[model samples]
Target: MTGPGMLTALWLTPLIGALLVVVLPSGARRAARPLALATSLLVLGLAVALTVGFDPGGDTHQFVETRPWIPAFGATYSLGVDGIALVLVLLTAGLMPLLLLAGWHDADGSAPSDEGEHDGGEHDGKRDRKKDDDEVGAAGRRAQVYPALMLATQALALVAFTSLDVLLFYVAFEAMLIPLYFLIGGFGGRVSDGVDRAAAAVRFLIYNLLGGLVMLAAVIGLYVLTARAGLGAGGAGTFDYRIITAAIGDGRLEIPPGVALLLFAGFTLAFAIKAPLWPFHTWLPGAAVAATPASAVLMMAVVDKVGTFAMLRYSLPLFPDAASTAAPVLVTLAVISIVYGGVMAIAQTDLLRLIAYASISHFGFIVLGVFARTEQSAAGSALYMVNHGIATAALFLVAAFLVRRRGTREIGRFGGVQQVAPVLAGVFLVAGLATLSLPGLAPFVSEFLVFVGTFGPYPVAAVLATSTFVLAAIYILWTYQRVMGGPVAPGLEGTPDLGLRERVVVLPLVGALLVLGFYPQPALDVIEPAVAHTVELVGGVR
Candidate 1:
């Protein structure tokens, strides 16, 4: 049944699985992976059903559920999905199962065994010793913890995407960090000794919490203002997003210029750090490089979208005047991020870190589309969010397969991977091309829309940002050539091609990218109405 409660069920299914995993005996903890996979699959099914039932022609949110959450503050346990939310929810659901499979061995606390070690006379002993050390390190990690945390993170992301109440959205936003901190801190590949997982986790938590506290203050201030304006005179200052939005749009809630700017700053700052544009992005590369591929996918592909999503959903609509005032500054930063992230990606020797930088650049495009303030750009931004998650997840999953084989993420560690594993190499090539926005790939469609839409109004900014395409090609192609070309690395001759499980993990993403590339109409059909509505809301204030 496509009822209002379906959204809650979509997120809660995984949450319940996490709790079930928690109560499982230590001996049965291995079951946690399968349990998580099943739960994620169920959620995916529900999301697909929701999409089928969704009314694309409608401008309003569908399948909405609202209940009094905190009557004193006018916050409600409200949830709804428009086209933008629906697409992102689909992206989130689609990626989870693949992440689980890609990470199967890593999460289960197993390292590749040394059963077939190289027998070169002098180097054999050293290679065997290194393998032994790796196995020991892998065994020390808890099996249940990683999968459980992943499921929990998925649930929080769903809530964040669907919540309509600003307060509820904030709570979901902040609550997300808790599971993510543990995931990054507890499970992941190693970084240098000086920057342990704990340190990465702490840095991420501190940065996000600082943003959250600022946003909390802004939310409170808006509530008080609405109450004082007699917008919700009967009870606590209404945090009802619609009431506040209408009041702001109609010029009924008269905020002083100074106060509006402050409120706008608070919201933008939080999203900027989360979108991790330019200077605020220092934490991402370290976290992504150190995280296990599965963790990295969840963090970058799904979780980070919340930042740009919030910028579009709340920042622009809630404070249109402030957004207009700040658009130039925001666009400039986005252009810088696009170029900067691309250059950084070219210089990275670590595959995981390279992906991290690539995402920074991609997010730059998404944010630019958001602030460009046109229907096409806004829809493209939403589509970019979905497309990016798909493409990036494929890249991470394929890279994880390579790392599992070689036990290293260093780009220099391998040469001529195609000679040993042509299928894996092919998969990597497709993902890389997708990242660089190859035509007939999903990313190209959305990116083209963004440029077309932005160029009409911000021609200079759009032209500057287009330089990213060249930089992207250089980094993606160069990395591929370095890692997959030339003679096979000496020890990698025995490296196996992608097995059935790995293929299963990657094919769906590839298929989706291809299908969307050729026919993005379905997605655009869903996204257009929401974009039009947002444009209308912002226009009302103007």
Candidate 2:
């Protein structure tokens, strides 16, 4: 039998973990990391179980749960997962534990602590100076708050991914911001080059909130349309996705072209800002540069997927005609993002900012595939989301390790790192290769599928976007050579290599990319049906 309440359990586990973290005595704060890790592990187990139980051939949502939540507004506490949602959920669940492990020591260093109480005569003046530095680090780190916010964000993300009610999705979408805002504003990375973490957080919040407000208006408009068409629950407008999708699909509800396009723009704009497409993506570099590595992974690799996910789940399916009409413009923007992000990445001295730009380029490929509207490309786009999470997480985590070692993110600060930390160098190289879509890596298959699929319908755009491959190699390998290949820089001789814990944290991400690279069929099998259905909804070809 299908596991009942499995979906509820998936999200609730993390929410409860956050609550536990909050209630734990301050002295017990050390327990927070283990608690968060255990909670994430549980969620991962549930996600894997859900995946194994899922019938890949089935077209409908699995493990469905629904209850009246805001019936006055026709919203429900609904949750379910199709293949698309399942994979993204799996990505989120899988990454959380790794991120926690990667940040373990960093978190400890970040926690507030009394470093001044060392035993008398045991601490020398030099040791006292080091102790003072440690204290500063601890003062900057919000160990308990970081993990708690991460869990909270995960809960909201799961809700956004699984919710079948449009209103519920919006609520989860907006709710996710609170924890992330604090994470960025409160526990952000070392400020460098005048990039203020608080300002970055504020910018992120303003842009997203504006997009959300626009989307809220569109949601209301959709509710009114369905109501006037007598297409929802009790013939009143409903926010139920099933009812709305059915009404639109069956022609029971009709929306004017102008109104449909307007609504489409509302949704698309919001998703784009979150996706951080081209011009809209201005907030991401600063945010990514300012936030902690764990926070960056959560935001970029997992949370940002929501934007593109919404586009595929709601935008294209709900407004096919508008999507079709706007495909050229969207595709153009995607191409620009691809080129612009890559070129900008090549110019970045900050490693985190470089990764952020790389993500913009990668997101361009995903958006291109989604708007391409073919089954293969769309499925590739879905798979790309998962692979990007794996690859980007690996890159960011490794970079975080490097930064922690060197005490700087400036690319110019180090040289010949590989000579000392060969294993660390090796892992960083693999992650960089994956980002560039090197053959035999997980990202290649997905990137290839995207190109092949896009070429069939939008060859010119495809050709232009392909230039990103060259740019990617330039930035990735050039950075590698400069940072790791040159003679060992002075004062860098003692930089420790990847320890057992760091290796454990990174190996899974690298292993995932390798395994999925050679054997993508299993993931593709799960994604194909959902993609086919989506294409059908958009009146696109297989």
Candidate 3:
């Protein structure tokens, strides 16, 4: 509301929280989670304040904070948030506390070992001692590391969302992989296949890094173009996004058609990979299944949004003509992503993987709305981003709760779960219903907007993408019937319902979905201006 200091604090608060967590005495290990939770809650409050101070119709970038970081290189520590960024910032902030809560005990487990079961009796005593030591050390490690990583994730993601500098966004985007890697590999749950969690983490990293490397080359090329045209901050190259966009807006610097396409390709490819659109999306299912539900939701709902948000923030504005030209092809890919993801989701036995594939389909809709470039489509795309995050997070987290009880992710292994834990079954049903974009739920409004908006410009793509309505219902309801309807499968009869802590974690998410489903106007009010600006930038047509 006041200055750039708040924006810096938006990230710095969590970073500082992480530092504080890492420094906690071993004896205070249990304090790490609550501390991280407190920090997240404070940030949520700050987000609320920022929302109040944010004038949607006012400046494009609100509460601007800029300082010279590398004057010679035309880079500054630039941070600002517009409507698109603001909503994403709010999403990141809002989800952190819930994620932390959902994952409260996730970091408590030790490195898995079954060696003693097969080992001879003579070494049983020795093996027991070794196991105890491992558990103790792991407990100590979990006391600080897991929560710290979550805080670090929030810190990095907030910076990426709020950044107004191309270099800053890229750095934050890539840095996200580090915490995510450990959150998945180190704290991840191994699916039934028993594939090494680290392998999944490695796959995620490699895919994203490759994309980032390509973008780096494009970043350099952009600087060179700006430097040659004398458009950078100094007389040299600048990574300032606002400066470049302003120059592009008034016709001061015109990127060559070929160069523009290449740059657009570089940025869009990176985003598509991050968005995990269709062919490049192979990594997400493994990574999501391997990680704990909290970790997986963090990646999908919060971290990956940066990819789509960048599409709006950087890719479209930076090369409006290139984006417009590429719209048809991108929309085609989005359609395939929708159908491909849904079919794959329907085929998944593992709970987390199903949710992962489902998310891929949801993203297809978001991307379609994005490149379709109509007023309703763009606005719906932005709104869909928020709703999808909420719905998916609710679904994944609730489903994971059921899986955790049964000690498996396989759908065949679960049955009539509602018979034992009706509350758990009920929450799962709500989440699943939201996932299918049922009417009177949060996803429906945004989804309807996406279809309505896209139909106006890309009728065929919209028609094909709407097939998700049936696909989603098929996957969601079929899975629901298999998992919750018939009879409680063996080993699950003693399953417990949602605990008080779990309720605290889940109820708010479910509430958000219900409220937003009926009245999405508040969020739409905060979102539309930025979407309008983006549509205008891309010439308001595909």
Candidate 4:
């Protein structure tokens, strides 16, 4: 039995860390680093403890902590995790400390440069000289702020995933944007050519904010409906997901099928923009190009999962009939996104942009699997989310390393990289193979299941999607040849290999992908029950 105190601590730990990091003085910059790392590590330990405590046989929400938060609005400071969410939560926690380590040096560096191999004494001397120079600039003055904000972003993300109260979840969801906006705007981008990180941040914010505002309206509407049904005596209009899910399940909260569709449209629209499916995907290429590797991984791998997770957890269950009615429309958009994103990937010269477009194509597959509405499809979709996160994170880390060494993101700028940095090229190869769903990699099984399940119900869409996988091979292999196998580009001589720190950070992601690929039963077993619950909830109404 998880206590309310433990649940509250889980949410507050990061938030409190954010504030502490923000206030830490510039003179105490090194001290702040440990604080951020410690906070994330503690959170990770807590999450692991959560898993050990979790009962595999129990499909219901575990570690529930409920208490009145706002009596007037029927909101509570409630938190719980099911098996499906528990896995994701663990993944999220596990990733954060590594990300913190990845960004530790540059989080506060205004004019960031890749750290070079050096003996400890020499490195310390160089760092001292750099710090002395930095002390004279505005960059030094703001060093503490960015790192603190980064930690804050991680904390808020954790809160959003764990919150049982829908309104609290929404708040955490929106709150996370504030720190990320600063991270991209303040700390990321190509510093050499004076790339405008500020512009990219603004673009990221405007696109997301527009969608979030619409979601706000839909959220309010849900509360109003809950109130009309006399939930919580109509005083507070319960915003607890469990309560709302129960009400919808019991036939107490009824809305016209048309109105339900409209509300779901709002919710789905916000998620789609985040998923950045096809036409709504323009923001991603820019943001990914502008962001630091660590930030991009979090944005693409973890943050984007929010949309798909919400679709599974909220949209389908609450409005089953509407979801069914809208399935074909969503599927159409998804298929178009599949072909369009792949075609765009074929056109990209920039490695970062290519990865961004790849995500768009992959997202289409995820959407296809989810909306196909078969049990296997949904289960595959869930597992695909985890698989994609691990693979994409690995790919982005490799790309960032390439950029650091070669001073370019252009595919045309490099060739025969494998000759110089065989280890690095090998990492890229494995990650690319995983991206293409090669057998014995994480995505292969999940993708195969998606095609198997969906082709039965959506043969045409599945056929079109299968073609995208062929295109996936084209873009992935094409880029690989240009960057790794052809003539080594001039002046990229003696490029350093992956450092110990990078290997320590990325190897886990690669290992997880392989482990899950070969044996996904552990994840499948956990997610199937949740997927079945959702399928039954939605399938019953249909």
Q: Top TM-score: which candidate number?
A: 3
Overall local distance difference test of candidate 1: 0.87
Q: Is candidate 2 or candidate 3 better by TM-score?
A: 3
Clashes of 2: 1
lDDT of 4 at 351: 91
> Estimated TM-score per prediction?
0.93, 0.94, 0.96, 0.92
lDDT of 4 by residue, 1-542 (tens): 24556656765777788688767776775677788788888888888888787776785777888878888988888888776677778777888887877776665645454343345575577797886686545565455665577667777777767788888888887878898887787777754644567788898899888888988898999888888887874455888887787788888888788889988988888888878776788888888888888888888888888777777777787778889899988988889988888889999999988998998888888888888888888888888888988899898888888887887888888988898988889899999989999999999988998898788778998888888778889999999999999777897678887888888877888898889889999888777877887788888311
On residues 303-397, what C-alpha lDDT tens digit does candidate 3 reach at each position? 88888888888889999989988989999999999999999999988877899999999999999988888889888889888898999888999
In model 2, the Cα lDDT at residue 534 comes to 87
Better of 3 and 4 by lDDT: 3
lDDT at 189 for candidate 4? 70
CA lDDT of each prediction against the hidden true structure? 0.87, 0.88, 0.88, 0.81
Candidate 2 wrong stretches, greater than 4 Å: 109-141, 192-195
Cα displacement (Å) at residue 248, model 1: 1.9
